[model samples]
Target: MATARDNILKKIKQALVTKVPVPFSTHTETADLFQPSQKELEIEFAEHFTNLQGRFSFCSNQQELTEQLSQLFSSRKWERIYCIDEQIKDSLILNGMNINPYNDLAGCDASITGCELLVARTGSIFLSNTTSSGRTTSVYAPVHICIAKTSQLVYSLEQALLQLTNKYGNHLPSMLSLATGPSRTADIEKTLVVGVHGPKEVYCFLIDE
Candidate 1:
């Protein structure tokens, strides 16, 4: 006797095998969907990121990046910054910053993280579980500081996804996320609220590589 679950599975399998024709289909399936970007990837990304209320800065070298971060730290007076990447933590510590490389997300003033790729058109930071600064480190902190290289910048999400696939041929990260800007919601009374579910402030430091 066929049960309801079995019948449902059978129907689903049949649907999966059945090919449905589109009522309105374009024969040019391989054509590009969006117009070409007019400006440089970095410039476009910076503009879009700033428009989304995300702070963007460019650093010429590691020394410049350190100097810029130190200045920002003094300005903001961030005492408890959480960073888990050993390389970044070491660099920060060597430059006289007190960066702890342990799991301390609950009481961090800010978090510094590394991204997998950056989407220029969307001004989004693409992250994956493969990095030491995983999903939670980027999302949970009140302030998120993402360090990205100019080489990681791509024109669109599709390009980023393609790069990611090429970078990790057969094995992709278990999880992937895009941080377009700071957390925001307008669920209650239609009033826009930022930092409701995630970081209130987002800063991206683009290093020329």
Candidate 2:
């Protein structure tokens, strides 16, 4: 007597021999999976980012960014904001932010860094190891504050990757990360927990370029 598996295999082989019309044969490969949005890229990014629980802010200029940072710091009483990027540090210092050199990361309340590209479609922040901030600065901190420019925003992941390739040529960074929002994982007991592995709060300051 044949086994149940043999019967299933025989049926599958017979079905394979019976050819049918291909589903949606007229559909082109270039066809978009999602409908095109009328909203601006900035607005779309902000909407998706906020929906992902990311704190999004649009700054008219660098001065506005400074002011917003000051307000946020003051309101949150955040004292230890660790920054490894020299340019960002200079900007903050020039803006009159009291930043003391932090040797221990344990005392750090937040971290400020720059990202490679901001994906408008997914509201993801694409990051590479090119910046002085390195890898640890963004993730180790409880709160991550990313200072991005409007010029860095791209429509999709493919666009971002293409730009990255053009920017870096053959010598790409060893690691590339796309941070969608504040890091969270629902692993243990299926209970959604925030900041268990990475940042609890993610703030993106998009400055007009």
Candidate 3:
């Protein structure tokens, strides 16, 4: 006797195998989001952060989120910090930590932003680039921190792609960054070095909704 979940999955798989298009455009749009399982994504994200050279931390709520993040900058003695979006900006200001908006991208020691969603399938954070400040704040700084709600965590890349298409309607941006981990390179002797081109550190503050 197949369970309801099993039956649904079986039907979905059959549709995929047969290339049967879903009648609803919305459902059809969500078809290919699978990548890796949730457990796999957690493992991958943990492993990547652990082996990373620079600073890294993950928080599951606003209190610890603020503490860990504030500690990151304070420990590093980062005086000039910039942030994007209202959440981080408000947090910093309320906590008596000064965070300037990204008027000048290249000069900040760290920058923070909120993400649309986190694709657990690939350990990637999707930046809409809907606002110029958010894009540059994430990319240009030496250290980048992103705040995401746990409710925003989706199982697969297909979910993320579907959400983007539905929300933005096709005018996605000139640049869409799917950052899996910190910017890294194996330049000399093929030895991996993190923070080569972009932020040396990518800290995720996962707020539980």
Per-model clash counts, in order, read: 0, 0, 1
lDDT of 3 by residue, 72-180 (tens): 7789898777765675678767866555555556888877777777766456777767532455778788888777777677666677777778878878776677776
Error of 1 at 66 (Å): 0.6
In lDDT terms, how accurate is model 3?
Answer: 0.69
User: How much is the lDDT of residue 35 in candidate 2?
Assistant: 50
The superposed Cα distance between candidate 3 and the true structure at residue 119, in angstroms, equals: 1.5
Question: Evaluated with TM-score, which candidate comes out highest?
Answer: 1
Task: Estimate, for each residue in 128-187, the C-alpha lDDT of model 1 and write its tens digit.
Answer: 976627669988999999988899999888778879889998899988998989999999
Q: Which stretches of candidate 3 lie over 4 Å from their true place?
A: 1-60, 95-103, 187-189
What's the TM-score of every candidate structure? 0.86, 0.82, 0.69
Worst 10 residues of 3 by lDDT: 48-57
Q: Which candidate gets the maximum lDDT versus the true structure?
A: 2
lDDT of 2 by residue, 1-209 (tens): 99999999999999999999999875545555555488888998999999999999999988889899989999999888888888988997887776787755657988889999999999999987765278787788999999999999888787788799999999999888989899988898899888988899999999999
